[model samples]
Target chain A: MYPTKYHKPASIEDAIAALGGGDDAMVLAGGQTLLATMKQHLASPSDLVDIRAIEGLSGIAVRGGSLTIGAATTHAEVAGSGDVREQCAALAALASGIGDPAVRNMGTIGGSIANNDPAADYPAALLALGATIITNKREIAADDFFTGLFTTALDEGEIIVAVNVSAPTKAAYAKFDQPASRFALVGVFVANGASGVRVAVTGAGEDGVFRHAGLEAALSADWSGSAVDGVDVAADGLMSDMHAGADYRANLIKVMAKRAVSASA
Target chain B: MTKVNMNVNGKAVSGDVPDETLLSQFLRETLRLTGTHIGCDTSQCGACVVHVNGQAVKSCSTLAVSLDGADVMTIEGLANGELHPMQAAFNDNHGLQCGFCTPGMIMSGVDMVARYKAEGKDLTSDAIRAELEGNICRCTGYHNIVKSIEDAAAKM
Candidate 1:
């Protein structure tokens, strides 16, 4: 059974205080993934700090060609926001396509990225868009933020306040979704050469979501589907599961990168 | 336990609830609003669907403490005594059989229709079906659910 004392903090300071109380405290944002994990007894926190009520923590804003999204902003808001749909259609599309409606409505970008499910979609967008995760303490680049499967650079007691993404000139995400779960079997996000064509692959990597340097380099040369053609990805660190093998995932990296490049073009 | 205060169906309600208590449990157990059902403990199932601040959310995945100062609208509050247009259409189009999933399905359906109406866009069957994908029903195969939402669109 889930064990926790629910605490609603009026401020970020209070929320952090709860986290530092020497208990296994989990920060609850949308709780779309966290609660489900709790229900399955995958996690048993001594305290749950609910931060949704904390003011000034949920919104979307575009300033100076950078999109600053509050950590608590739900997927539904991101997908349906007028600014997001117009300025970053690819991001909106990715948000809209994440799990079914309930998940979209309750799942936040911070929670999803923090959970770092191998098949999640946000990590690709974060890596490709060159987003900076703003926490209570500091800002970390997306490249350095994600460490491994279900791990991040975030230290305990640090809460993600917002995500600031330097808007891409053009971008697109394409994913081969697992039918039942709707999680990506192979998801790819490609941005234009302004950022030198960063390509982040999810669902196929053993490390959860990671940038494909080879594909990025190839696409930097030519921003087209043919750029990554015949360029094989190394299967050394690809995930092998009931869904697909390591070699198949490696192959899919190339295919998905090519498709993303073409779609963005 | 946490003391929670929120607007439910446009009325303010306050109560003390446990941190481990899901919004679904609060609505069904404490408040005794049984319209919202819990089909799965996981967030994957939308049987416990409810409107938290005007958006359809999985009640099972949310905590009452998180919604302390938010606005919530459950399936119980969808209509004013009489059935909403979506409810009427669901009945007319045979949108349900087992009826276990009807409450959640109808709540999501009405929310989608309201959202589209606010945007001044006509609701299409595809759009309605896409939004309702969060809600699942074991019966009717979703054939009539789609038809009911479409029919409800016209009536609205």
Candidate 2:
């Protein structure tokens, strides 16, 4: 990896100032993806703004039927937090299932969502649960937040302060995990939240994480495993990889949708 | 060079390292503690697992500078002249074959078991398998590795 400047700010304001100064800087969250990309020489930023030291950026809070997870909160913390488990069991389960024990313990929610890897599990949950991403600039809805593959609505100087996800009536996440890296081959998150029935699928679609409107409509009418049995997600733009074909992914979407509904029940 | 301060094995140590210096490189090079191995530069491999603030994290994916003032525990810090309980269990259960992935496996397993015990929950094979899903072991096929974690949990 090429040498670069490392700045550890005493506060979030200082970090923001460092970022605002016109330099190609990458906010070092968990470094799970960023560091790997750097080592591969895919991304050579001029500076790294270490954000781990910023106090109050790591926590889980539940109030008024809303669960707010701090940006820097590790996946392990989300999985282990009684507040998260009690409120959003699907989110906790998703966090617990991400990568392995080490990855879960170290990787942060902010980093995971910001990276927005096609196969990442959190994106599915966030979208299905109608989570709001509270960044330094503004709060963006989950649907609007994720623009495209590996793309978020965040500006260059913006930082994710926390994610405010409303509690759902019933929700569950299911994934066909890839063998080697444990990333999702086709992960589905099903939720009947205050915003109504929502279904989000990750890893299977070529467009990255997306909502299955047909499945959502079917399940919204009748929230049951069998409700999703005959619904076929279009394979037109689904991913075809060594692990699974596009048709296979489309089929798995229905299966996972059913399983998610069943699991939540 | 970036000047950073970190606590390793309960010792406060400060050093100057390259800005791009990985936590694994810092441990092995600057600190001269080579117990943590880097199997893959990518975060996919758990060969460089370590505890940052008592939680297991892939050290190779982290920067030495990012760990300033943070507590770290490597495989070298797991024991003092004697094998850690998890290490002993792995030996007795034949958890390691090539031994290349042992340190990471042990580090991750220690955190899992400790967390399980703290939660007052019983550790099962399924749970251990789920927990060890991140650490890759090409040799043992994970049968004995899972058993070792269970045995260690029982002893604890």
User: Which candidate's lDDT is highest?
Assistant: 2
Q: Mind giving the per-residue lDDT tens digits that candidate 2 earns over A22-132?
A: 368788888777878999999898888878788888899889989999999999899888999889888998998887777776789999999999999999999999999
Per-prediction TM-score, please?
0.95, 0.95
The lDDT for every candidate, in the order shown, is 0.85, 0.88
Q: lDDT score, residue A15, model 1?
A: 96
What are the chain A TM-scores of the candidates, in order? 0.97, 0.97
Candidate achieving the largest DockQ? 2
TM-score of chain B of 2: 0.95
Tens-digit lDDT string for candidate 2 (B1-156): 879899998888888888888899899998998889888767776888999988888898888887778999999898878888999999999999999999999998999899888888888899888877778888869999999999988876
Q: What is the Å distance of residue A63 in model 2 from its true position?
A: 1.7
Model 1, residue A153: displacement in angstroms?
Answer: 0.7
Q: Residue-wise lDDT of candidate 1 within A1-265, one digit each (tens)?
A: 5658877788999999988883698888888778888899999989888787788789999987778889899898999988887777889999999998778877899888888888899998998888899999999999999899999999989999999987787789999888778899999999873466788999988888998888888878878888788576899988998988988888888888877777773
The C-alpha stretches of model 1 lying farther than 4 A from their native spots are: B10-12
Task: Kindly report which residue stretches of model 2 are placed more than 4 angstroms away from their true locations once superposed.
Answer: none
